[model samples]
Target chain A: MAHEHDPPLDPVFKSSLRELKWIIVIWLVHFVWVLGYCSTYGYLTPETPLITVIGMPSWVFWGVFVPWIAATLVSSWFALTQIEDHALPDASPLPEKSEADEKGGADHE
Target chain B: MNEGSTAALLTFAGYTISVFALAILSNRVGKGKDFVGEYFLGSRSFGVWAFALTFAATNASGGSFTGFPALIYTHGWTLALWIAAYMVMPLVSMALIGKRMNQIARKTNALTIPEVLRARFESPAVGLVATSLLIFFMFFYLLAQFKAGGIILSTLFADEPLFQSAVSFVSQTTVNIPWVNQAEPDYLVCLIIFAAAVIIYVVYGGFRAVVWTDVMQGIVMFVGVILMLGMALWQVGGLDNATRKLEQMIPPEHGSAILSTGTVVATDQTFAKGTWLFDTGKVFRLGELAIIREGQSSTVPVKILKITTPFEVEGLNAKRISGQIPDPGLTVRVTDPKPYKYGAGQTGNYVRNPGPDSGNDVGFLAIGTAISFFIFWPFAATGQPSNMVRLLSFKDTRTLRYSIVTVAIYYSIIYFALIIIFCCARVLMPGMEIAPDQTMPAFAAQLTRDAGIPWLAGLLVAAPFAAVMSSVDSFLLVVSSAVVRDIYQQHVDRQAPEKMIKILSYSVTVIVGVLAVLCVLNPPQYLQDLIVFATGGLAACFLIPMVLSLYWPRMTANATIAAMLGGTGMHLGLTCWGYIADKEFRAYSFLGVNPFIWDLIGSLVIALIVIAVGPKPNRDLVLKFFHDTTSDGS
Candidate 1:
């Protein structure tokens, strides 16, 4: 790949944004799965229609976990996507400057 | 010889030795600095697995297991609403707060919460207030941990006279001093365990060591919860059986019909009509009612003869004297009633007391489940001072992230398992005649007795000790850091050497240990209550200032300082007086108008007002602090 050194494109922001997106995607998939399971199973049981797996009943799984997964995914995506990678410069390693090499007069105090 | 005590002793000894050995091994292989980071934050060098485990350890304390479950058992499932509220907190934190905090800490070389606040606000006042709140609140919180540890010890070992006698024998043999009487040798042993744990990680490795240990402890905790829960559930014949048992044990009136119908109530009391009134004798009064009972006077009618009336009354009759005296009988009634009918509502309907069958035990599990979301999310993105320090001690963030994630998954599983197990305990041991807080430990003992699984019971009993030790060590490190880094090093004498920092940290740790011992010696009546009050106060003082300073450019030092002081004052004053008055106020009603809610509201309000009214901060400095991307580049 050609090393395209885009002046303002901050790599850190890009990576963080990418990470956030993936997390949201995973969270969404989980949420949808839960919602489908709860809704489908919930429709089946006539008396206690809520399908309870383990100790957590189906309704609780729907109400609590589904919403939580959805919120995590959506909110994280929104927050992460807002930070524009083009607005900031890449945070690659910079050449080290010793104390003695400063342009201004050294004022240790 | 109580089997519970014997099992508990063996379990405790095993865990202590294992933890100690782990600490020693980590120390031996790692450099002092590396060990410090690992101990505090699990070497922040952790892979996803370690990171998850550390997070679990930090979050899961005695509060989660004992206090939370006890609260649920006492209050009913309505308390689960709080857990739902908390689910959003971590996601909010990660998406909104974590990234910025992590970036800032990495850039500024801030190793503690106080340091981060100090750096962001550019005001010593903010730092001082935040540190003070942290110390004060954490002290109470730590005390709760200690007390929980003591209870666990007593529960697990109280009946083992042989173990008690052995401990007593050791104490007497080691230091044969005359006229020395220790109350409950088991309590002292708990104290020593906590003290030793705190000293090792804090005195030697600092934040880094604490984190590493936290990571390990967190994993163990997660696994422990899952294993125990699974075993309990399987023993009770799975979810169907468990639910059936719970239904049978719980009165028909107390069943959750609404929840059963796959609907969540907007309010907690929707199912109130289906539950029995725990307090049955109370008369139901709608809106208001005044009771006026006409009866014969307790005092016989007295004849009064005055000097002026003596001439008239003496000859004919006596004048009856009746004076209004204070009514001796107490009439209990609700003054201000809502739409809900009193006593007719479900057992969990009452805000103050949820009846025994209120399905409140489920609340703890709900909270545990919520906590899992934050366990290893974002791969340790926030880098909390303690957590960050651990990360820095690690070789790289990739390792930290991996360890954290691994631990997170494990923790989630364990947490879910614990919930299942605890609920089963509730079903199996309905109205179990033990202290509500000791329900879990007691149940574990019962299981051991019934099933003859000494090892599992022993392990379950020792879990609380592990929790206490992990939490206490972390608290000590944070407290010591505040003293060493913020106070002694920063304020008292600038340019303090590393040696001096080490010395100060150790000294602070020792002092805190002594204080903890003294505080526990004569614990107050409402220790847990006091802890909640303190946590609310601290959260109020710091959360807003920290959040705003991280995200907002206009947050000036003046505004931050004002918010810190104003918020602290408002929260502390309201909380203190409110507790004294024993009446809830509108201003105080945030999250049931608890002190924490009040503090959070007060701080946020003050911060906003200050930000709006005060002059904008130095824009150049703000940008340099917040947007300096190159500052973190190695």
Candidate 2:
């Protein structure tokens, strides 16, 4: 199904995309945990005995502070251990020459 | 000036001189490299510390120092949830786009975001549109930071005799100049000084200067927050004590009032700005200078003074006075007092969600708005072109990976510690609600003075100043590069010589900075609001299009343009609607959510629609950017 002009995908591009997928997943988890927990317990009724944990509102301690620490740990782990390092391609010729080459060659096909 | 003021000024001088030294050294180091590449991109060589700190410092603008602290002092503990998203912001902002953007830029030899987009699509139109939007949004962003710089400097030198003399001289000299004369003399002088310093350093040294300065600024911000945290906790006994006190604290009622003399006074009496006056067992601080002119019954524009607690009154050292006293003959008759819509006379508002707001009935951070900010901090940060520029300059993926972890821990400490320190600020410095933006600097000065080490305030105040300067310099370079490289070299002169490029770059950077200074003569109040609007607008315009172009090979030029223009239009349209409906500058949250949420949604929808209907992109272009053409069509 591949076109004649299309070359194989770059290995670095494939590797980077794979890492991006994991990063997005980690971000989504963090997003849900922060928004879900905070929105659920943030709005408290005046009659509810204002609970305190370590001198902070109990909800904040559990919702934001705890999740924040956890997210930091997860993110650090992912960045340090999970992400792959790859060799970047050398800088190409000036953009004008490349543009002219493309226009003269396969771009018009 | 007192010893504290003198020491603070001297320390500030030393910091400024050191920055110039760095800029000069950076310029000399870049002498042999490609002029444009080295000046704008630092020859694409950034180590972990340089990249991480520059990225972090640029993101931590005036809003972090002035606007954010103001919100914390006013709204209390609710700010925790508001800013909690920063915990993952480093990973989200950097890791998501860093490697891909770097690869793309290197592949295209692109020096700017617009340049990268242009090269990706092979269309000059895309570059032009991107350039236009970048300049437009960045100008507003520059105005906000310039205003913050002026405010910080003004606050730092509030008691200095030299600064007072300069303010007075400028006021007298510019009394007849229509535009310049309208601003407060102190603020105007400070704005000019701040603008000049930033412009000179950036124009001379360029990108390397910005990165080097950012490294130092980042360290100052981190150390400053830690010191303040320790001192604040010690001053307030502990976080628990501060929280308990905050629970019982009442929000002040602020509004303009008419101060009348009970009798026509025999002598002309003048009350300086920030003077504390007491009447009817209540305490108030004059927001501006009040002069009872000879033989006049009242002063016409006696700016606002809020009704604060007697506990604060004792600390304020307020004189025993009444509204209708014959001896001094000063009558404090309040008019048009505007009380808070929520928690006006209540306790326990500070430590709770939907905290008390001076005007908003929905309170400061409604649940919907809270959800919006959690998304805003990371995703919006990712959208910033300034951050994108830093992404392009890091040495390699290892540097990227390590810096991500470093910034994650750095922001965690800075943002969380700021909340704790400013919450304690309410206990130590009352009546700050009158001028909330000055809370950080004022608190720094007061905290150190109380500790009998007033000179330390300079280093603490420098944290915010450094933040503003780092952002301003980066933004100046961005706007300059847009004009020089994106617009000029791409369109006007592809073969332009290097010497001409250097002259234009410097000239454009200085011109833009000066214009920004002039624009902020009467700066917007609540600097955080302006910061949010500009930053949100930029994210709305650029985030989706840039992401798609980097990853999705099928994306066409038309689709990218649609996303940028449509996103910006939605954001501006909503902001205008909000202003017309509310008679204020804030964005109209159509469904109790921040306008940023809707803007992103709308941008994505528009981009998807365009991509669906538009012609397919060039397959050859995809081959170039997304595949290994170097390996020959295998």
Candidate 3:
């Protein structure tokens, strides 16, 4: 069952778990805030209008804009973290020598 | 300037600005080696959140906003229950499909969904079948989005044909076609918008860029829908006022009979006499004289119905009680049918019109709201090439999970608000029946006319273009990756230079863009229906094999291949036959019995049977794939 191609797991599983915990906590905080705001301030139908925010209404601000901004921030944070954690490491790995190199350089040359 | 011209100008400008912005962003970010791999698969490192957002963005597409709303308006709110299927999808995807697929994909370095199939089954035929199905279905789905975009454009800029003209001119000039200019300006404009956005992103950034942009666009879409909904509600006074007006427009009696059917009761038994079985306490009383006799007629019900000691009244004492029976249990009186005009001589006649303005269609709204809440939320995550790339791009799973949870909450709110607003629009424009495809845009236009909020209307119109273009760009990246990476470099010439891959990518992007444009030119009457048909087919064909291969040790390669072929073949056969056959044979009901449901069911059944009937796979290999307890401990 063992395969040589199987990737090695870094011993950082614990730290990774810790980092995930922080992310979930922050996300939960924001989620709660959004839910509270939507429940309290959201205009369920068109007839129950709220005051304007930058020519847009309060319902728009709370229901749409607020959640959007929160999601963007969270997503951006995740993206930045991902670039740091995953892509950077893999990109920097030593480029494997091809068959041409083993045969003493390019055959065409 | 006319509303059409203004809207067109805004739409064209918005798309141009966004695309340019995306291009600059991609250029600033270094283009890595393994361009196809890095760009399309994000090197296969996508965590939960980015994966979720990218998935969400892909699923949201043009149909979510325009098509679904139009359906809600047409069918009434009861149809919204169909969306309940969505909530279950994510749980199924994450627990059943996504985690396993991620494992296999990472292990095999499989770039596409089809690649995963190939690796699992070790069958080229399986790969080909899966790839062909993916391409075929995705193309139809993409075309639906294109059509949606076109409809939005036509409605938003009804008068000015400038954007449409530009699209036609560009299509003709680039592809050497003289006849496309004669097509509808809406279709032309949508085609050009999609072509430009997709070509640039796929050509430059590849998959990485597409995924990143999906995350961004997903955020924009979530916000845009919400803002549109809020603005809509504001125009109709407010929620309370809108509800009141809706009540005035549609009486309670006119509400959906199907919903009320759940509340009906037979009035036969003595204990239940005069009382609706569904509403027990109000209609019949056990101790009191509940029924009254008319003239010389016998007093029907003076009974001790069931209040502990059941008994019946006899003789003179059973005489009918006169006058007001205090709180005579609520009688759900079934009213007569009221006929309403629909499309071209079609009349929607309801048997029990609750009242002149009973908002019965609210059931549709409720159902739509529920659908938007769950199933639609997860849809934002499926079959997106750019999203897969983004997930692959992620540095770790932690970031991905965070991104998913955030996007999920964001999606939930935005969709809920949008559905509410559309339901509100139903009340505001009771008799307004623009084309189903143009429902949301027409509503926006009406708001502009009624409320003088051109800016808001313009934004609403632009939203679909943004949503559709984002999806189209992701699809372009996918199609291009398949050609450049999977087919050309990998299969045709393994030693092909990076330059060739880049060239192939760009060339494929352009070609696909052209094809997409051609498809959009001959648009379907219902873009939403087209999208569902395509995505449902994909889900049926891929869902089981992808999941079982990753998770179940018993899923043999033969079973996997069989499931895929069986699912895809049955789906296509049934769908084609349904579409082509005569009316009676057409098993294309909207909810209870439809081609999509049939396809999904067929695929699930065949896939299960194959798994059970076929020989078991190497259990140890399956476990290694699923439960490899290793982490890059760096």
**Highest TM-score scorer:** 2
lDDT of 2 by residue, B509-538 (tens): 988998898889977575556777788899
* Model 3 regions more than 4 Å off: A1-109, B2-11, B44-52, B84-95, B161-182, B248-393, B448-451, B524-529, B580-601, B608-620, B627-634
i-RMSD per candidate, Å: 10.7, 3.1, 12.6
**Which structure among the candidates has the greatest lDDT?**
2
Q: List the candidates ranked by lDDT, beginning with the highest.
A: 2, 3, 1
What's the TM-score of each model vs. the native? 0.69, 0.94, 0.65
Chain A alone, TM-score for each of the models?
Answer: 0.39, 0.75, 0.50
State the DockQ of every prediction: 0.11, 0.54, 0.06
Question: Any residue pairs clashing in model 2, and if so which?
Answer: none
Name the lDDT value of residue A24 in candidate 3.
Answer: 41
Instruction: Report the Cα lDDT for residue A16, model 2.
Output: 73
Query: What is each predicted model's overall lDDT from 0 to 1?
Result: 0.50, 0.85, 0.52
lDDT of 2 at B535: 89
Could you tell me the C-alpha RMSD of candidate 1 in Å? 15.7
